[model samples]
Target: MIGFLNIIVIICIIVFALSMLGMVYRVIKGPTLHDRVITLDAFGVTLMGMMSLVSIVLDTTYLLSVIMLIGMIGFIGTVGFAKFLEKGVIIENDRDNNS
Candidate 1:
C-alpha cells in the first residue's frame, strides 16, 4: 500500500508540474496585465503544491518551512502587483505638509 501511495503522490506531482507549465504560458501570452497577474499567482500556488508533494515523497519535514515561505512571498507579490495595477504605483510617498 505504501508503494501505491507513493505512485499516487508522484502522479499528483506530475500533474501539478503540467498545470504550472500551462500557467507559465498564460503568464507569457495573456491578453491583459490582469490576466498575467492572476496567472502568476496561480503559478505560485501550483509551485507550492508541487513542492509539498515532493516533500511527501521524500518523507521529510524540511520542506514545510519552505512551503510556508513560498506562500507568504506569493501572497505579498500578488498584493503588490494588484496595488500597482490599481494605483499605478506600489509605494507612494507623502510629501505634502499643510500644518
Candidate 2:
C-alpha cells in the first residue's frame, strides 16, 4: 500500500536525520584529525541516504544524478583525506623551485 510505503520511508528518513545529527556532533567534538575525517565520511553517507529517501518519498528519479554526484564527491573526499593523513599534505607545492 502507498500509505504503508510512505510510512516506512518517513521512518527511515527520520533515522537518517538522527544519525546525521550524531555525526555532526562527532565532527564538532572530534579530538583528532582521523576522527574528523571519519566523521566527514559518515556525514557524506548520511547525506546520500537522506537524499535517497527524499527521492523515494517524492516518487521521482530526478535525484538519482544528484545521489551519484554526492557519492563521487564523498569517495573522492575520503580518499583525499586518507592520503593527507598518511602523507601530511593533500597537494604538494613547488613554488620555491619555480622561483
Candidate 3:
C-alpha cells in the first residue's frame, strides 16, 4: 500500500513539473494579456498541487497552512488584477462607482 502511494506521488510530481514548463512557456510566449494571466494562474495552481504532494510524501501537515495562505493570496491577486484591467485601478476613488 505504501509503495502504491509512493508511485502515485511520483507520477503526480512529474505531471506537476510538466505543467510548470507549460505555464512557463505561456508566460514567455503569450501573445495576449489574458494568456499571461492564465499562465500566472496556472503556475499558482501547480504550486498548490505541489504543496499537497509534499504533504502526502512527507506524511506531515506542516505545509498545509502555507498552502492555504497561498490560495487566499492568489484569489486576492487575481481579483485585483481583473479589477485593474476593467477600471484601470484596484481601489476606486469615486463614491459612485463603489459597489
TM-scores, each model vs. reference: 0.91, 0.86, 0.89
Q: Which stretches of candidate 2 lie over 4 Å from their true place?
A: 92-99
Model 2 / residue 76 / CA error / Å: 0.8
Error of 3 at 72 (Å): 0.8
Candidate 1 residue 65 C-alpha distance from true site, Å: 0.9
Candidate 1 on 1-99: residue-level lDDT in tens?
579989999999989988988888898899999999999989888889999899999999999999999999999999999999999999877568555
lDDT (Cα, 0-100) at 76 in candidate 3: 84
Quote the lDDT for 26 in model 2: 88
Per-residue lDDT of candidate 2, residues 48-88 (tens digit):
98999999999999999999999999999999999988988
Clashing pairs in 2: none
Residues forming the 10-long window of minimal summed lDDT in candidate 2: 90-99
Q: Which candidate is the best by TM-score?
A: 1
Q: Would you give me the overall lDDT of model 2?
A: 0.92
Superposed Cα deviation of residue 96, candidate 2 (Å) = 16
Off by over 4 Å in 1: 95-99
